[model samples]
Target: MLSDYFPSVGGQRAPDAELGATLRDFVAQQQGPISAHLRHRHTQTNEIGRCVALWPVLAHIAQESGGAALALLDVGSSAGLNLGVDAYTLCYHCGGASVHVGGAPRTDCRCCVASCVGSAARSMGCANLPVAGALSHRLGLDPMPVDVRDTDATRWLQACVWPCDLVRQQRLALALELARQHGWQVKQTGPSCIEAIHAWLDGLPSAVQPVVLNSWVLCYFSEQERARHEQAMIDLVRQRGVVWVSAETPSLRPTDMALPATPPHDSKGATLWCQVSHHAGEVRQRALAWSHPHGAWLQWLG
Candidate 1:
């Protein structure tokens, strides 16, 4: 269904065609580190430039909620390693053989083309800003989380990574270690994960704004499941919560960005870091992105 909707990695169902023969072999083997390395290697995220692009909008969520202490959730958060985004002071290591991290978020301005959804998100009045402070509170949720601590799980995580990019693998390792150092753990378990999240939400003192984001989750869901989960989200929204979700377009119908709309395919270059606040069925979208990561450009599609 995802392939029918939009182009997946290389748009090929088979392994060799998408990432090459090595990946196909690795996936079939299903070894531990190899899977993780493959996943980290090919599945993006190591592109710190892209992730940092929307720091500010995320920061805005913090400001709106209260401070650096708002609950953050990442749906389909593979290894759940990136959930510890706050621990590492990200630095873009692009155009280099090794990851060139920085002690802090880069301070530079860059340009990016807005996606159709991004344009609409801007129309909704979202503003992007660099926010190290807000990132401190981010968290994650994934169905088959890669157990970074378990040797086998780590191996599986690496194996799923694209076979070619060792840099990505190393970057993931570093990020996982950093997250672990911070006492942030991602669990591998049941449907109650959502329930646990709701419980966490319920536990919050309400002084902070609770935000839920599930980027690229629709691809994994069947039509029925998508309907059910989306309804759940709607119920959450009705309860006055904030949700940040973006799925590749061609995979979904193009509609108002304010409503539950699929993002456009080929909408590259820019990201929509929007905040939605609905008023009597009328919602406003906030478009924001960091624009740059210490000189290197980034695409933050929050």
Candidate 2:
């Protein structure tokens, strides 16, 4: 149905009037199917483009650990495409300079692009950014996990993407294919991200540093839930020595968390990238960067 309506997915391009009429007619004819879909499906976009923003942060983590193996746990990971972050090629443009990471020759990986914005763009050096190494283990936790191998689920993921955004559609296709080839594990867990963390953290190998990550997921939780999630993350950091990385709206972030010295020029429509960790007895949170919700651009604060 999506492919039939959107030209980007091989649908015929129609005039505005024709398109509206056709959509209305289709909806009228497919009322039952549409109703069933609406009742069961949730907006679960697995935006692989966000991996561009994640790459540098993971690299920084690896560098901090002296290149030790790291395990990744992604909360609300729909189809777990971003788990294969190291499998894609990330191209970043900053201050008229560019840097590429991941995807060796003959890999046939899709390229995800991003740019550095604002004052940070001028000072940021592509040379100093650490390269993200291979992840030791990648696990995803979601209340309702989408399986990339499932035809219906995969189609729904495609539908979640904006019809006009052909670039994102292509990226998602390539990412889905990569996910199928890799067969990353995504466990169906409870609704609370905190519960998922507690359930999975103890099972990871002690030798590998655990990095719990979530992108644009905390907003789904209530203010109280968010606070509990934050406290849980801090507890994990203090007791289990894990790192928490988040890419969410600033307003959604815990009030107790530290703010960046220089905030983004425009916070509206921007996602805040943060890293929370505990060393000794104190817990610290640092706002790493501010980025587009879909990784179009990033303003570094680290």
**In each prediction, how many residue pairs overlap at the backbone (N, C-alpha, C within less than 3 A)?**
34, 0
Task: Note the Cα lDDT for every prediction shown.
Answer: 0.46, 0.74
Candidate 2 TM-score, C-alpha based: 0.85
Candidate 1 lDDT tens digits, 187-270: 444643467567657766655566666544455667776666655655566665654443222333112444322233323422
- The 10 consecutive residues of candidate 2 with the worst lDDT sum are 102-111
Number of the predicted model whose lDDT against the real structure is largest? 2
Per-residue lDDT tens digits of candidate 2, residues 15-76? Answer: 55567777788899999999999999988798876776787788877877778788999998
Model 2 segments more than 4 A misplaced: 1-5, 12-15, 98-125, 258-267
What's the TM for model 1? 0.60
